[model samples]
Target: MEDMSRLDNACHRPLRSAAALGLVAVLTAGCTGTDADTTTAAVGRAAVETSPLPTVPPAQPASQLTRAEVETAVSRLDGVVRDAMRRTGVPGVAVGVVHDDKVLYLKGFGVRTAGTKDRIGVDTVFQLASVSKPLASTVVAAAVGEKTVAWDDPVIKHSAGFTLKDPWVTRHVTLADLFSHRSGLPDHAGDLLEDLGYDRSYILDHLRYQPLAPFRAHYAYTNFGLTEAAVAVARAAGTSWEKLSAEKLYRPLGMDSTSSSFADYDKAADKASLHVKTGNTWRAEHVRDADAQSPAGGASSTVRDMTKWLRLQLGNGTFEGRKLIDADALEQTHLPHIVSEPPHAPAGRAGFYGLGWNVSYDDQGRLKLGHSGAFALGAATNVTLLPSEKLGIVVLTNGEPIGVPEAIATTFLDTAQTGGPTVDWLTFLGPIIKQAAEGERSPVDYSKPPASPAPAKATSVYTGTYANDYFGPMTVSAKGGELTMQLGPKKQRFLLRHYDGDTFSYRTTGENAVGLSGVTFTVGSGGRADKVRVESLDTTGLGTFRRNG
Candidate 1:
């Protein structure tokens, strides 16, 4: 599954809390085959149970492929990737295919950056984004294999600092729950904290103030929850998450090009430059430091290294005849722990969430386990394995909001199944992308104007420092008849233009500005605004900030 945390809306707008939820709702509405329904389970939690996993018919054994057959089946993939790049304007991509536990094809196409001659290679490192989840889960699986931690153990047992708003949830949430994304927090619940320059530890500490859904009631994909789980695993293993992942998975599999640290990415000789499309041009993007949330989506790797990782996954924790983890422990990560509410597209027979993978049966009744990673407006990645066929494919691209990786994955899987490329993936996906972009740009009225016009307050009354427990300080300053609000650590300043009453439309300035949103100030006694509320796609609600000075 794509990391909802980083995915923008169909219109390519800056993703806020509401837009993120709305996008999920729109995309997943077809997944459930019905309206959004919430059910109260016998366990006293409200859960949304949608389509259940389809029962797999008796397995069909896959045929062994000769080297020639594999070659013939994959000969068209290069053309496919090249055509996709031409269609989507993606700068560079690395493709890898593993069949029957052997790397059949691993190559790179296009240049590392637009208008640059430097080519992406098999070892060109790119941020794995949410794809880091499975790797982190594998490390935890290794810890489980060592008897250092049990999957069902409460997170508090390992990390005493772990907590949530509800005492019961804090006591009951387990490592398994965290991996499966069932911690009750909404999707990307603590992302604002990260946006405010808070580290993982601070984010975890502030989780006690975030609202909860239902404990074990819904599948909310939360990067913060996963980060906490990784911390718990690290604590149990007596090592940091990065160190544990390296020792347990990367080193064991000889994935020398992979590292969970951005520092390592910076030091790498060959790295794919991040890119985003702006006005029909693919522009390089600044690298984001994600080391603070490394456990959730902070790994950099290459197609060469990813193929090895895929081989291990297809081998059920074994790589090169070495059993790095117990087969049963590895299998547990693939088992469905939570039923995802909105079905992801190209709907499989049944969609479910495993520890670090999306477990579902393809339309052909083959078990398809995979995950897609998206670096915020930089890179896109996909890794898929069909254990029944001993087939896996990895596609990595340097582009924002593009479906090329997914298109490539699906086309490759289809080719493997039919012995030929039966799908024009670009042709099929182009319209969908266009339609999403159009739909996202459609205007929506979110304003509820006051019944009557109120007197305008003095500009000085609205200027002050407002504080949020999790997001830190926001200062509204007025000078020369203009008002601006500066966010905490990032100090992102947005120009505020009065709209109606105390509400003002704000547009971010500078190169990193996301987009326009609205903010409302609530005036109290003494004609001074005591509270401010912001409306944006990234926030779940108003995100009230109180006047502290």
Candidate 2:
């Protein structure tokens, strides 16, 4: 969802095309709940130069199209999923398909919870928000094929309180540099401390106080910097990233209703529920738990356990006849390590990320790969693979992600690669997912304040508490005439309001919410204040706080 090809907006502001339309638009957001554009501290900054991705040659072995052209693009995908659910009223959708290797397609559409007669089943259970990053990179490529952890190791050699505001990029960051968001760690770093509730060991122990952008040469899409590299490759595989993703890849590929565990997608029994729209309908509003970034945006499955993991990722690691993950460690989670959307001109189309996969390559060279789990508080899942035509598709949806499952996997892989659907792709991607979700918001409207506003002081000159070694304590108080604030470790609150001299505002609420913001303060010497700031927890300026005594 956030590849905007570098025009800059989703997945932290680069939308020349929104990573060619997959899952994005969540936080800074796009994949893993649409992410980055803003952590892992000490702030070196200025990095995003980008480069690689020119390679092409070798896509010829002859399997691009057949089996009656993939059963005539699966008989026009139930009329393109009933005309994209009669045009974006997305109550529910589930789809799965795999080719050459089998499982042709499973389906489901609408009504998991809209007005309700309950339906939606290709075995229901939805929440794969941020498409749980390539299903937690196939459970860290089956713990690097049981050698126990090695995609370039180093997440402080297995999370000894992992750091990053630098210290040599915290002993050289790895697990493929935060699963290819490249450890420059900004753009969704520690995601607004998990939208203020905070956990995942207090957002990976405060991404060493947010800031960093020049290590493996910056890109951004971070979901707790890939959940601190999948909780340090599940602490070097001893276990518990939901039991190493049910013992190395969903119980050896039976995928048993998948699950990196948000309490097993809140006790499944055919799940769905996420919804959001509001006025024209879709209701079930936000319940996104995401088990502290459960390996980056909590996992959940079904499209019949994601087409048995798309037949074990086009069977490179083999699924049904045995092997279970280690086709040279899942071919290094499909190559292309970084540059996720850079080439804005000359040679044009570029984009990639691999090892948690978004990657690209097409114009006949083939490769492709993708990711797009979303949840601006609902869910919008997606997947597309080509692997030189073993072909693939997944599209789950509950509600709130406007581009309805990336226009049904781009009109079912452009009608299985060119027989139809070149456009009207959900009316050409619903205004590029409503202009990359209004370019990740926060342009500062604060509902419109500043017209002779200024009179605040003596709410005990802004009450007490404050601290903040990365959003730790906050307090404020006030009561009757009203002020509030509180904060993380479940203090929550946040009423504020005022908006002028000592500045104030609030309205924000969850999933990396970017709405009202600003809090300011700064007073000092007996006026009783000494630093406050907060503007949506200051993206790397580190959001002030101070006081304490």
Candidate 3:
């Protein structure tokens, strides 16, 4: 099955995290000093000097804190953010914090675009990516609040034409099943189609062809699965998902700068352009249009607008002295629905998925809800809420995930609780992000062809139209001694270069694009190639297209 676990490494927006308080092995003792008195007689002389008192570290924020003590951590966010920017070179960051129904902090650091004078601000919009999941849940909660859609309602009751591979599973799956990502869809079931330029409707409808797990018993993170639930809720509300968000969530909260439409983000006068680090310089070299999975990962908003949503979450569906949505429906989004992270050790605590958020409980039994959004193309964001203390913080960045946003949040949160960050968060997060990014590449180096490769036959043997129900029809054509492979709704062309006998290589391009991948053709006794294997698309053993003739 080509190691389905590779999806975890390539996954830019991982739904679960291994960095929770109880899971990460934090080694706190690093000062490397011994305050021992070796000379007993010298004790009388300046009290044995005591090795200069071993450089007593600053007091850590308590392991737990009451509402009044959170200020210690919230106050240092400016310097914390500046240090993070200086250290990580993430280009731009916008942070907002809400406490006690008040805006505690609103600030930005670094330029909106690298190598430019345009500075980011609280109102400079940035793509939310998977963080949009939690916000979409808020919109759905409003639908639930108004009785337009129930959390447990079957999806087919609202959105038509949605089905899974199993008809019984299709008939029984609920919005909660999809929202919590327990619908048995393979990990990132339809994202490849999106990368190939397919729209949301095509991807959603075609999900029935992918293989399934044991229904709600398995936990596989699927963006389109969660998106399907949002589409259904919008259908039940008799509105589009974009308008449903505007009417039920954004407009009501006065989040004028927030939008589910990519056009709004594309044309924003003040927006942080997505960036990636290139040879020690941050470059705004990529454009990401997530309209296909709008509800799952496409929303964009400024910190000023995000703070309002934070206030709503901390206020139990209320905003500025008004009840906006039902607290019951909204709070349910924070309840644990599935086991997202099982402990590695018996003493560790398991993390849970609650609607769109990563749900966990602290040592104090306080509820902590958070979500991270990332696009390998560029854009990292995080939103965390401590509802027990009515405190929440959101961090947005316009760069590929390097643990910058998550590190900043973890530092602030650590300071708020324990007087200071107990661990170097970037030290842990940087390696994980780097590993995931590298893991998305082809295991076999197609760039380096096999030595003494077998020569290919005439190009005529490979030119034909091959069909697969999953990948649709793929046509390979050759002109003037060059071969091109075309597929997808647009029939996007991939120039094929000879790699070996019956094998050609093409550079993969898209969200899931790993690199140069093999396209091997199998010739039959009759002479014409019968099928072609596209390695990049065959993660689940489904990339082979058979001859239709």
All candidates: CA RMSD (Å): 5.5, 19.0, 13.0
Q: Candidate 3, which ten residues in sequence have the lowest lDDT sum? A: 28-37
Comparing candidate 1 with candidate 2, which one achieves the higher lDDT?
A: 2
The superposed Cα distance between candidate 2 and the true structure at residue 166, in angstroms, equals 27
What is the descending lDDT order? 3, 2, 1
Please report the TM-score between candidate 2 and the true structure. Answer: 0.37
Q: Count the backbone clashes (under 3 Å) in each candidate.
A: 5, 41, 5
Encode model 3's per-residue lDDT on 1-92: one tens digit a residue: 00111123234223122112112211111211100001212222332233211122222233345555577777888888888888888999
Q: On TM-score, who's better, 2 or 3?
A: 3
Q: Over the stretch 186-237, how does candidate 1's per-residue lDDT look in tens digits? A: 6666665665566777888877777777666577777778889988889888
The better candidate by TM-score, 1 or 3, is 3
Q: Cα deviation of 183 in candidate 3 (Å)?
A: 0.2
Q: Which ten residues in a row have the lowest lDDT in candidate 2?
A: 25-34
Models sorted by TM-score, best on top:
3, 1, 2
**Model 1, global lDDT:** 0.69
* Candidate 2 residue lDDT tens string, 52-161: 22233344345667777677878899889888888768888989888878888898987888787889989888887677877888888888888887777777878887
